[model samples]
Target: MRKRSIAAGLLTGVGSFVLATAAQAQASAPDTQSDGGAAANSQSEALTAEAGGDIVVTAQKRAERLQDVPVSITAFTGETLARAQIQSATEIARQAPNFRVSVLGNEDQPKFSIRGVSTSDFNLNTASPTGVFYDEVYVASQALGGSSLFDVERIEVLRGPQGTLFGKNTTGGAVSIITRAPSMAADVGGYLNLQAGNNDYFHADGALDVPLVQDRLGVRVAFTASTSKGWIDNVTGRDLSTISSNALRFSAKYQDDADFTATLRIGRSRSNPTNIGPIVNGFGPGGVSSTGVNPRINPLTGQPLGQRQGAYNVIGEIRAYGDNANLTLTKGLGDLTLTSITSVIKGQFLNTVDVDGTNLDALQINFADHSKEYSQDLRLSSDFSGPFDFTAGLYYFKDIADIDTDYFIAGHSFTLAQSYRQTRTSYAAYADATLEFAEGSTLYGGLRYTSDHGRLKRFEVVPTIALQPTLKYNDAKPSGRIGLRQKFTNDIMAYAQFSRGYRSSGFNGGALNSAADITVARPEFLNSYEAGIKSQLFDRKLTLNLSAFHYDYRDQQFINVVTVTSVGLVNAGRSKIDGLEAEVILRPAAGLSINAGLGLLDARYTQLVLNGVDLSGNRMIEAPKSTVNFGLDYTAPIGNGDIAFHVDGTAIGKVFFSAQNNQDQAGALFDLNARLSYKASAGWSVGLWAKNLTNNSVVTGAVSVDAISQFTTMPFPRRYGLEVGFAF
Candidate 1:
């Protein structure tokens, strides 16, 4: 089905080339762009207005066209995201190829997975395989997830392991959120927006920029707040309101006439949202009729699953908060540039959920954590007078965290009250250089050396049992990338790359036994080989990119629930992932644009053992076999204003949420979104947007507590609203 859908999407993209536009259109992009930002160059009006132009990116820490970058990447400009009504990370994934970004218990913690590399366990102690950054500052905690897309800049997604240059070790990939810098051009120029919708929803977000000095200094402030009454019926109250979020940020920039620039930024985000929002679970294991032996009953209340009003007897809530600050300074000397980045982040969250999926008080859980991180980086980049180009950097990082959890089941409660403290000190030096020995060909290579040291201690008490764990370790790892690229023409390029990635090992804080589980899980190793082609065809009206990749893995971290009171990670030994991906963008005419992406993956465990049983050949959790994203946008000049319409959808293939691969745990998802907007020359506009038009009821994710019971969560219900905006 996915194959046929992909083919049909391609056909439509081609057929519309000669039949979509009625007339030429006008551009509706921002008037003045910001500093340290990529400027887009569009070929035409609609393409420029709705689709944006040739995006400039810093995926490799250097400004370059997205298509010219050797790595597989995707970029979303602020204009595109605003038009598409993408407010968060999950929405971005709906359009990105082979990417899936989800949250555990919502709006606070995000699980960002690119291709098939991911960490399935949703624990505060275990870090996500993918890395997330805000303006070059590494966000190291799940508590700091859910970055709001507002106030400025663009978002860049880099696929595949980035073991070099970046501050963190990520086996999957990275998501970079680049905020708009303080603007000196806009003395009083900013934007204000207000939105209202069904479900008693209301939102307000805006930014204000002030020029402190004519050409020397600028200051910017931004904020966003959203609130909505609950959608699902709740027995504990009238209804539960799960969609509540708020954020505030401030930035200042100082530039001198002598080629020196400095920027300071600080932000905070807080949300008191609803959770255990809605759920339905009726079938038993294997999805067969529940026999008396395996009764599908909430033992405490004897209530069957799949309740009509959301199956909750108590109110569940998630409290999340984050604070961050960063300072960036840059100086230019001839053809060489020196940069320094200093950042610190602190975050915490507490989540509560009704675990049993029924209107009974049979089982419930509360999980909470707090974390702090600090890092400093110094780098130098050069575009020499010769054919040689290089960028090198030195980095240092320190991280510490604490955690606690409680579970209540069957008239009894076990409080795994724990205090965990860990400190990570890392020092790394990396360099990447490209030498253009020939006219349109280049030889590229990079090397990174990282020395990581850390210490951890944990004390936990479950009921009357107490467990204490302590450990200390230090290690060094060397990683690098090698690639070759040849420009067949100005509009076409081909490249092949081999890269090695690494992730560190860490101690499992809570344990079944202090002595037996004090040591850390084994570190992970990954090697990837990829080749791809990028082309701008049909007079630059169409952009097509194709890639094939394979990965070899070793000592992978596979987290498993050992018992109700403890969890552990095991080395999955070895595994392999192979995949093919295609991304296409077509500008059928001046006022129409269409994009489609398809991904096919075969991810399997070649060797794995659990409890003396060989679990090899099992499909990886959360890794779908096939995925597709399709979108279309149309714009037309109506009177003195331009009206634009957009529609997009994503389809995911079947996937299991557990290692057991239970048929009952296998499911898929399909979501649709649309927008219509009218913009006039008066710096004012209005729009209507709808997400999940079909209100697709999808089983988003699941987890197994034991052989007899499991927990699950679904996608958010449909959301539609009207928005009004004015530019200052």
Candidate 2:
């Protein structure tokens, strides 16, 4: 059935191209001299009207107007990111709607999700549901997980499935990070930022951009350091605090603009001991301490219960180092243009943490992981006006990683190590063409053919038990999209599209225990149908976008609790999710803006049976039913300076934490930030800022374990600070 669908899609795509060509040939020929001048002027006008100045994006592997794209996307400029103080991917999560980011015990490992579809496993060998891309190159492993936001030009977040254009492993969505290119002009500028707040917190960041050669080469360097005192106290009278991190980044680029460009980047970061405070019972409902004792105790009685000092003992530390290099060559051949990108990246991380907190007795665990990735992509696109616009690309990726760990638990000590190597080679050919049937209406169709091959190996070791397993998987998926856009008026447009996406499967890292290990699962598939509208009102000052979508998911994979000896992860049954989303951006006046978004989701299991019991009506775990986000920002001119006020808030409705759909949790939180700045001169400024004015203690996440029947809660404390900066 899948093969037939692919064949039909290809036929339809080709037929559309043929019809468009015939129609173009029958129409009156355009005047080359006069029409060419008018077309150039129109393009210039369009670029001038872009949001934030003329910005170029490579969403389709070519520079194009963002407004002209048919997909729903959000683009953040470098200035905007700096104003919002977004330093990492985890911070970006707070601003995007229906998206969440989290880190496990290891700061070097990160998990990302969009619209409630995510992989929560912390294993080093598993693939993420959402894909991460840097300068069009994919990051291979979690060891290269968190990226520093230094000298970045822009970040594009494409919502929904992007399998048709981005290829495999992107069933949920994709994030693209575009770095700033070196400038040829001999100009130098830099910024220094210092922040200090409660909890003995301090942060400093600096950057310098310089032109190495006159209109030929350039270099940029950036560094960051931060430290904070712990808010939680330990019973052992030890200080559980975090030390400052030292991070440095350097970038060098050479460009002559003819046909070739080369760039190289190197970065190193080291983090001091990060304290994971003692587990306190009663913080959440039905919580108990690890030592099996009451959480709430009288400070003067009960043998002091531990010492209520503001610190815990040192647990572990992490250090990360990475290097990346890329070269791009572009040349025009007849009516077609060929472009090639070759890149290599290598990264290493070292993590050491104390598994258990104790004064006289201590338990510690150390982990070291490293990874290397190399890729090459070649693309050919046509610029000739032949009633067809198309692009084709070839991609190759290879990765190898190793992990070593030493575990110590009181009287027992053990060492375990594992290694993984994977080589994924994909060949994809995709093309999209638009048929101008009449004035203000067009038909668009696209098809993509992708072939992938992957191999994995795992080795486990113990004094008494040792096991090794090897697995290889291959798949060929063809995805297509057909859509129509009709311009009803000058300011209103409507669109409808049908698209398909797939996610490859691999080993389950969360199922690996010292005593038992389970087999891997297979890949999953998704089909989505969507329709939307875009409107501009009040003289283009207010914009509204609304979309509704339905998705059919098959062979959903999840972690299940079997018997104590056989607990592991597996591929579960199928499910369905349908939802609606709306976004509104209003610019009432100069220097003032309001943005709001809302999402409503309905997700449930369609066919799920376990242990002779039907589990069909269960709501998806950790998936919220509704979410809301709102923000207000205004900047006003003052005497020789400008003052800004901003407020943003997020609200998540009730959600179930478990598969049984019994536990319900909900919350709403608000964050307010304001700054008053005085411009000292042409290149310097000073500001006073305040954050979390409400000082509300909000819960961020919660989890419940079936083995112990205990729940754990994580909360974020309020913080406020002041800063000074300079720009030239």
Candidate 3:
């Protein structure tokens, strides 16, 4: 009760402060800059003749202003992301609302969840509710998606279910990345960025663009490399938190004629990192023999501890590699256009860790996976001058994966292995249409049909139990959405949307003692409804967006560890989520900006009964009641150079790890990041940055093994660095 009260008070205080500041800015800004009563006609209206307040986005498959889109989205450009010190997708949670990323085996592999709907399952054949895409191509492997965010042009995070346009497994939401295109201009340009930070950290990013064939062909290449020393030094012997990584991307474009254009891109990435340190029984001194609930005390802070430096030691590491290639072709007709997309991805990773988190190596676990996927899409879009417009597309995806797990036990020196191969083939068809019957009002609807076939083979079962050598499953689903939007004024817009989304069913492929537990996992679905309003006040100097949403989810899939090397999925019962979110962007003066977001989520399991026990009314996993984000950016001109400063923070309320709603199964956390920079007149810049400035110990996730052991992971350590960059 004390923790919850403190968290609520802090969030309310911060939100109130930010709102007051925005109100003051609104009262002060003069409305001299004329909008000329001209509002944007489409959602992707790139630029306007007015001030630089409105942003353009392509969230609806067409160009439109942010305020005109019916869905909720938060977009960041390359420059903005860099300035915010956000290099990976996992860091996006610090700036967005109702979004979180949980790191798994290593930093390269992350599980993304939105609005309390996400996955903890690590099966190769299962898909994530939150879809991740690069350059419009879906990347199925979590081990490969993180590298794609490094050289992106823009990232768009859609808040609600984007099932219709995205097609499959997008019941929670979708993250879309658009990479920078190759320029056809007869010019050579590029950039170089280098950094040195605490903990012996070093990083380098470089890019080069060239016009190969004057006005017809062009190429661009970009690469990044980084290394960091371990943060946790094992008292017993070796260190457990080092990192090394490298990634490269090459792109080319051909536009020989006005009607035909094609672009191709290829990327590769590799990383090696020692295992992150885990504390002993994060929920306290509880054990299998004696279940005593005592919070693990941090040796450094003496507070309820998380995973960090400890007396015990273990030896383990992670090696991961990924490669992806994509090609897109577009052809223009008199009043319609045809497009084709081809994509291929391959990922391989090996990770090992000590299960006990103690010097006495009771159990050690190893997991390895190799995956390959191919996809193709064909679509046609009409540019009709009439009141009605539409777009239709067909997509096909194929995936193959091989996975292996090993469990090593001490004392008797016994080893166990669970190996399997999995494959999936999916096909989908979708169409979306819009009708503009009035000048400023529109009605839009979409539908998608998807079919998936999955199989698991070459299984190794428990020594005492007999299991099937092969398993196969097939499933089909239909998902879609409908929405209406109306422009009340030149600066005000309102919208309402309803959607249905689904996740595919598949084989669990676990080496469970019970054959029925590992045989199958059912599909899940969501019925979502949302309403929102977007407005620009004080002559576009202040922008505010507010939304309310409700989700009805059924057949939620839950995973529980059966052993150190294997886990089984359970079809947990129905759940419901109700949430409200608001964002404020205000510019009180030139070169000074402030932004803040508040999210309130209420999620609970409505009906869950197992073993004749009612487990309903429990809080949803990974869902926080209140999440608040606030930030500020200030820039001013000095004598010979300009100085800029930025500071931001994110706070999350209590989050539960399981559906049982045990008091000890929850935690709260916060983080702070800041930077200061100076720019010269010749396109050169230098900056000093800090992350986790307070060095506050916070837990991001925790899981309990029965009533015996609880494992917890923490946020990054305090890191301060100096950086230099040059642009052409």
Candidate 4:
């Protein structure tokens, strides 16, 4: 009955969305930038002359040339992704500067960070320190953060506190994705790509765009499906590694004239049997056993242990899982535009696993999570192109989540069921403008007033704990970017900018244990100062951009691991973080480019009381002091097609993995990825790609109490693949 009700609700919601789309279409105008004219022509030239194109980004809610932006950013075009073999958000982190993504027991709850500042917990109730946006719409849940790379035009990674333009938990940075819009012309073109690699990996993706009504309405649909055999053997013959996923997206647009346009998009993704491998000891050096003993053996049966051989197998065995539904609409209102995105995202994740792999008599555990999110946003901006430009907007979001976990220790069974419902409503009004003061100088300023209210209700069945918490926060922050640019000789420009950002505080659901139902925390604030230079030489064939930035952070929110109690999770203390970063992009030759970025972080606890003693001098956990990223790509013409070679590397400097600031174990690690592609015909191509080419063992985390220490490493071995594709 419950399943049926959910299905009915979904159908009704979609029906309403369709009606809204139709109504908006009737009141909208046409888009003037759809043809292959000035904008398109310029974009094409930019893509060919450089690795991708001279991207135009709305980082400040105003369209500006990417090169002209003084902030530290990494942008990738769809074509660049195809050449680099970057298919997912996790893959993008490997190449982007000062970025790292890691999963914590749950695949759906991954931690994302830039420049060593990140959220340390995987609780659904806590807002992510890093903000993720799709087509200008914010995705509020981590389950929906990983987007399918289909029909996407470009992705922009803005590294820094973007709280002013993005709003909310953007203490670290923001990731923006732009998808391809529908075309009104009758012409149709698409591409089919297939890839096969080691571990029986297979992937396929394609898209189709059709003009339903010539010059008035159009629709575009795309799909991606992939499967990969388990890479690691369980030794017991049980499959321990495997992954399969499928996604579909549809977009429709109607244009009436050059001033009004309406568009709607819906998308869904499903995956069967996702893998979160069992814990293993000796997987790398400095590793420790999670269960208790190493080389876990069956004590009762004297038989070899199965897949669950180690301690604390949080991610046991995958049963089945899927994510569904997203709807978005955009309307042009005369000189202003409004976008409303109503998304009903749902997922079911099940896992059954053996906690202790060595004991023939084992402990079995099962886990499941069901969640939904709804959000609305409205914005207004002027279309005038002059010395001054501006924008304003408002947003609201709500979410309901449920988690069920059962653990069976031999014959005894323990179950933990939690139902969490949270509502967040935010009213924000913001405006930004750029004033041209001289021939090559401009002034920018922005102001925002945001009021937020939230309520959380949580119920835990196992321990019989019911907790309710409510919060009200209001802040009026005025952020201005005063940048001065001087044209040294018409081809070179020097600039400097200063901006301030903030992130509000809220309840920490993960910290709600039996002993403590609530923990009071404060908001985090950041002030950034930066200076840079942008220059073009050799008749625009060579481009170089350099920037240096320093960030001052206060009242940073962090999670502290505490002993589990009957009531709920507990918090240890609070901390502060500050850092500096440098980025450089150089295009010394046409069709050849090199991008390098370096970050230096000094993060420590301002006040940590452990054992009734203040430990304010301790360093932050999992935050490396130094990190670097480098990329080199080269392409050459070969018969009607092109041959390209690309290489990229990421290096992380040594740092303490725990707040204790221990230096007994520290090491620097690096990873290298390379790819080569060749065109076989006018519409066909083939490529070979390899990742983790050196198979270097890198420790991502460690735990230590007193003198005993335990370490965890990802150790993703070398993987290689071959891909073939055709376009027409």
Candidate 3 vs candidate 4: the TM-score winner is 3
* Predicted structure 1, TM vs. truth: 0.89
What would the per-residue lDDT of candidate 3 be over residues 278-361, giving only the tens digit for each residue? 654633334321123332543345554334665344577887898889988877776666778899999897878665665565
For 138-204, candidate 4 gives per-residue lDDT tens digits of 7666756765676677788888777666877776788887777666677876889998988788889
RMSD of each: 5.9, 7.6, 5.3, 11.8
Residue 184, model 2: lDDT of 47
TM-score of 4: 0.82
Local distance difference test scores for all models: 0.72, 0.58, 0.74, 0.59
Runs with alpha carbons beyond 4 Å of true place in candidate 1: 1-52, 236-238, 278-308, 412-414, 463-469, 509-519, 663-666
Model 1 lDDT per residue over 1-728, tens place: 35435544543454243123211110222222212122111100011122334676777777776667778887787777887888877678888888886554675677876878887667677767778888888777777867666764788888887877673457878888888776777467899999999888898989998898967899889998888887665644546536788999998988898778888889998888776554534355544221212223444455543322454665877888889999888877767778888999998888887765555666667778888899998888885777788888899888888777776765444344455677778899999888877976878889888888877765555543355546777878887889997765555667788988887776665454444554577778789888777656555577777777888978777666654455677777888888777788988699888999988777878888877878799987677888899999999999888999999999988877556577435457888999999988788999999998978766656665554555556666788999999996
What are the runs in model 4 whose C-alpha is more than 4 Å off? 1-53, 106-108, 278-290, 295-344, 348-367, 405-412, 464-494, 511-513, 564-582, 610-613, 655-657, 662-667, 700-715
TM-score, per-candidate, Cα-based: 0.89, 0.83, 0.90, 0.82
Structural RMSD, model 1 = 5.9
Cα lDDT over the full model 2: 0.58
**Highest lDDT scorer:** 3
Error of 3 at 680 (Å): 1.2
lDDT of 2 by residue, 1-728 (tens): 34334333543454344334433422432211110001110110112123532244556555554434556656666765666666666556645666665454433455666666665454565667677887677786775656566666787776677776676667767787776655546788677888777778787888787898866688778888777765445554544534455677776766565644456656666655454443332333434334243444433355434322322244445666666776655565655667676778877766655433333223454656667788887777665554445666676766766665555544344443433444455666766556546665667766777776666555554442355566567777777677876654444455677877777656544433542454566777777776665555555466566666677877666555442123355555787777666667777888887878776667777888765777887876545677777767687877766766666666666555445554323255554544555555465666665555565434343333333322222333556677777877
Error of 3 at 247 (Å): 0.4
Measured on C-alpha atoms, candidate 1 has an lDDT of 0.72
